[model samples]
Target: MIKRIAYLTSPGPTDRRGVAPGIVTPGFQMEFVQIGTPTLVNDPADLMITDLAYVEAAMRAQRQGFDGIVIGAVADYGLCTIRASVDIPVFGCGQAGLLTAAGIGDKFGIVTIWPETTAFTYDRILRDNPVGRQCVSVRYVSTVAEQAEIADEDGFYQQMQAGREGMMLRILAEIEAAVAEGAQSIVLGCNCMSPVASILAARSSVPVIDPTAAGYRSLESMLLLGLTHAKDPRLPAVSERGPAFAEAVAAVVGTLDEPEECPVCVLDEYGNASCEAPSHEAAPTSADGTAQ
Candidate 1:
């Protein structure tokens, strides 16, 4: 039977959008939706918007009866929250591509668009994967100027076509650098790079993995095996906080353009919550485990 999967996008998270083109395998119907206001994910404010948007998108996809959901960004925003919220197979492009490369090669290389953000995110996520250390090198591309010119799908396609050769050369150079650093496989770390994945794969000595393709194909394989995430330890819904706390918190953080100050005198007025993190400089003795 043909299964349905919702490919939820983070919009312009890295000045790029959606999965790399032409990676879908057969036997599954896929729906692509830009789930949030486009944001340049390297920016803290913008990244936060895309992060929470994934949670809402996953809930909607599950409610709509989709068989699976793919977080389209290679950075895989809100991966944990979405997986916990929904029972369906939630494929994160980063994990899919990284794990795929890990399985096939001794060490994989990542080439991303942004310099700092992706490297940091990959470092954090790689910790949870046993073979995460196998990701040897992460090379970055400086494509902000060109991507900023793109405003719509027509423009994006036009840009990709006009700059295809140039983009390929730049990416090819990065792939070479990764290989020099002992990367056995190259994983495209940005969704925008997906279009030229085949081109790079053909020219490069090592395998070139497109994260979008890996993620979609992973979800497809999971369905074929009738596998889904474990239902235990679900993200339990919040039934009650209070009209005061809910209203106050929402008013303070309702959107990206929220008020600088809490509208309700202070947040502690609601539920005794503080914007402070408990001091973790030293270990705590109490069983309740509030940090010391």
Candidate 2:
């Protein structure tokens, strides 16, 4: 059984509320690591900066002998690289979100944070999965600028207050919106939004998809299956001097000039993107002044 699991994330209220619980659930011992937040540079090419940070963090965790690693971000930032770099299994919240949503119903809608990210995420999902047609819709709660504003301390507090005060109303509106658009269930698409998931579900008739719960269950299953942190034998070792492999690593970590296309992007029926990448970046500063 998997006794120990490592949960890596950027420092943020969202991560604390959504990702941490997945690690410490009943049967597992969890270790949480904080990394840098992924800042959106003017050039899209700089996206690799965030991706590389996650890989570096995973390598650190693997060296420390964690049983497995879970990248705890709604975006699933650097999943592919972390998986390739480590012998242990690496899971992403985004994948958990999709898998969880799928288990409950035929179609689901995602309520994510940024509009641009919604588009980018949708693109990634379509590229990764063969069954890209199952998603119903993926909507953004706020634009990137708005998200950034709310991510700040005062803004976050106000947003939280708004959510709490108008909890039922917001939940009802979101549910009605999704159902009207043909969603059988709703997936809390943002990590920050997870704390309110059960509240949303409690107020709605349909089910709510909680990525944290999904990720926790997935880790539990991996433990039960006795999975090992062994390298995939199919892939050649770096010592084998495979230029392509080296190039791929270089493409992912070398520079901010060109961001490699994430390999795990896939689509569900509703056109919502499924992220399988692990995040690499500094953790966001938390309002609570505690490490998330």
Best by lDDT: 1
lDDT of 2 by residue, 145-253 (tens): 5433432434432343235555446446756687788888776665545556667778776788767667656766777797743567887422222344435444643
lDDT of 1 by residue, 1-292 (tens): 7778898863221222344445555677887654433222433343454466556667767777898998876767778767667778988777888998998879888876444333555665577567779988778764434333233333332333334676667778888999999999988776556656677899988999988788888888888898975655544532122333334333434444421211100112122211222222232111100000
Give the whole-model CA lDDT for all candidates, comma-separated.
0.59, 0.54
Candidate 2 lands at a TM-score of 0.70
Off by over 4 Å in 2: 12-15, 18-23, 36-43, 116-118, 151-158, 228-232, 236-292
Candidate 1, run of 10 with poorest lDDT: 283-292
**Regions more than 4 Å wrong, model 1:** 11-26, 143-163, 231-292
